[model samples]
Target: MYCVSCRNIHMFFPPFSHLTIVSLLFRCPWTVMANFKGHALPGSFFLIVGLWWSVKYPLKYFHRKGKSSQLTHYYQRLEITEAAIRTLFSVIGVLAEQFVPDGPHLHLSQESHWVKLMNWQHSTMYLFFAASGVADMLTYLSAHTPVGLDRLVMAVAVFNEGFLFYYHVHNRPPLDQHIHSLLLYAVFGGALSIALEVILRDNIVLELFRTSLAILQGTWFWQIGFVLFPPFGGPEWDQSDHNNIMFITMCFSWHYLAALCTVAISYSLVHCFLTRVKRHGEREIIGIQKLKSDHTYQTALLGGSDED
Candidate 1:
């Protein structure tokens, strides 16, 4: 299926003028209600499972006792991902201009405002909260659950997996590389949401509340992701058979695709840096091994090739 982005970029998408007309015909109460139910059921299910895992298993894998070096390493990883997300959101907020309509109809395309920046920030922040919440739940479940229940975890792993699938299909990344992009996107999204709330003139609790609402609303993008490219081993159901296809097809997915793409680019840069460091370490190890082998060979030569 052609993406809204593909349509918009190619100038094939209908103008915003048709939105009202489409809203009356295609976005009626029945469709709206169906979409809501689609969102509500999966959302509530995830919430319940997340709460259960969080409460049932409170141990944090990120924390290490009596290992300052390990703690430092973990902190470094955290800081790197944090920076990646921030930069990702910043770039995304900047590029948001390109996707917006340039026609005389849309005001957002004309100029960047503090308010728009705040909204973009908030969107990222909310995405972060949701992703962190998922990670928290996954970590807890991994710690507490039996190996046999991996199936269930895989079932719900749909949320993250769906995001990855969408990333590849939308961005056209290789399958092996898509996970890295998704992980970075997830981190950037979470950070952006927090940045939004913190940057705005809102209380901490109010900001969190707002971020939560955004998380809930934005998760529909995942559902839409699931619909657009149903993953391998997914439950038996056709995308067209789903009732909320319009919600999946329309502006919501397009907005998220941009956000995810923004996050992915930032992640790629940051991850490249991290990978280079890792490669340097590996190369050092290989150099040491080669030196040791050369020493052994020289010793054998000094002894006239072989004792025999």
Candidate 2:
């Protein structure tokens, strides 16, 4: 319940502060590499994809009567691009999970040393997403399945990610366990939403809800990086502190609220913007009562009068 001012004169104009943001991204310090940056890479991926769904779904839903919101060729291209990005990022995730010098004992019980099972778990999680992307790409073939194969594939991927993380936190710090558990809520929620999309087929409300969950996961990932591994090499969190654990839970609830608000605002803005411009061959759909009113403008052209 405290508000702290980040207000500073130098920061206002010159881009002050350690650029902890930039350092969090680019610096090569060991903690930044293994902890913050690792979390952030996928965080960026989810955030961008969420924004894509948030924007595209609304445009499609609010299309004008005379035309589709997006042309066939363009929409197909966008789908291809989305799948490609997902696959490429997932591949990168696998690499990052395994290739580090001290990571992922990629062999089976190699003389009972360097088991590093967690590393392999993460790599396998990344592979699931890569599979989801491949399934999405197959849509270009116009292959018909009884349901949305891409959606179901993505749902499986989300479920797999959650499944891994749920077990990944065993014997870890209280703070780490609590934060990651919060993340599972979004992960499983998104998984269920995607599954429902496969069943419901083009339900806009579910689409928007899925988008919100995605953004929540993305933001939560970044927040996790910051909470467990403070930027600019700031002091580490007291993992055992009860108050710290309590605050993290509250912070997560706020993040959920923020994610919902983000989608709501984005939807509202797109609606307002789309309403202003009339599409080609667009005709107004007005009520019959309004059409009978001589004071109405479109009615005058149709020769309707109050008495008529």
Candidate 3:
């Protein structure tokens, strides 16, 4: 008979088992291995996209000589290449789901109800992935893009991620539940940021909050992999009642460090790219200066022409 508790233990405590090293390395099935891949894949997608968006505005602001509002008004305008990369990642995630053992299949009715529910849970994430991918592609194609649609799609994706994260937290063992719980809140915060952006229409702070949460989630995925599936045989924190406060604080600290590092790296790379493109740099600077000069000339003419 299959034992659910035994399966959960095996899933979380693979190293603690009394298996030979060779067996541990080779005998673990793909079903077991795919869990890490599942998290890591989406984690990478969010990390890259978040890193780009987090740096995009700051780079533009700097390029325009500290005139932040001189560029395009809306923030949803992303480079076509970057948007395509995000879409590609989402597509890959959707395709990757097909290979997972418990993932959704063509024949749903044949499966047990419990199996069906599990499959739905797994498939839901990728469905949202596909939705996000299409939305991004649409953004790339549209000349006159609507900010509301972009915000709505982002809101949907964030909400879906938040729901799945909460579900995982609820099912996690007590030892690991707190970390997942924090992650759930982070996801919600990202969703809230998106929602606020939808209402406020072009706020840098909201966009930063969303991107920050995405990076945090990406970093936490690696942390979960390390904590649950250690390199050697056994998890780092094996006991259910181990000291939780210190670890949680450490996780938060790691997130802060990761965010700072990601932003710095992204900013440096963006600045370098902008500097290398001579025509792009010259055109932006000239355009902003011309606009400023024209505004000044118009103001002087109006003041001089007016009869006091």
Model 2 ranges off by over 4 Å: 1-32, 64-70, 105-109, 279-308
TM-score for each of the candidates: 0.24, 0.76, 0.68
Q: lDDT tens digits, residues 54-161, model 3?
A: 788567556566455745444435555565666677666765666455565544555353443434554567677667667666765786767566677878887997
How well does model 3 score by local distance difference test? 0.66
Instruction: List, residue by residue over 67-167, the lDDT tens digit for candidate 2.
Output: 77557677777887889888998898888877776566366357666555766786888899999998888876465743599899999999998999899
Scored against the true structure, residue 250 in model 2 reaches a CA lDDT of 95
lDDT of 1 at 140: 35
Which 10-residue window of candidate 1 scores lowest in summed lDDT? 55-64
RMSD of 3: 9.7
Shift in Å, residue 230, candidate 1? 12
Q: Tens digits of per-residue lDDT for model 1 on 83-177?
A: 34434533443343223332122233334533333233323433443444344344334557343232233323333434433443343323313
Number of the top candidate by lDDT? Answer: 2
lDDT of 1 at 247: 39
* Better candidate by TM-score, 2 or 3: 2
| Candidate 2: count of backbone clashes, pairs at least 3 residues apart or interchain | 0
TM-score order of candidates, top first: 2, 3, 1
- Worst lDDT 10-window in candidate 3: 18-27
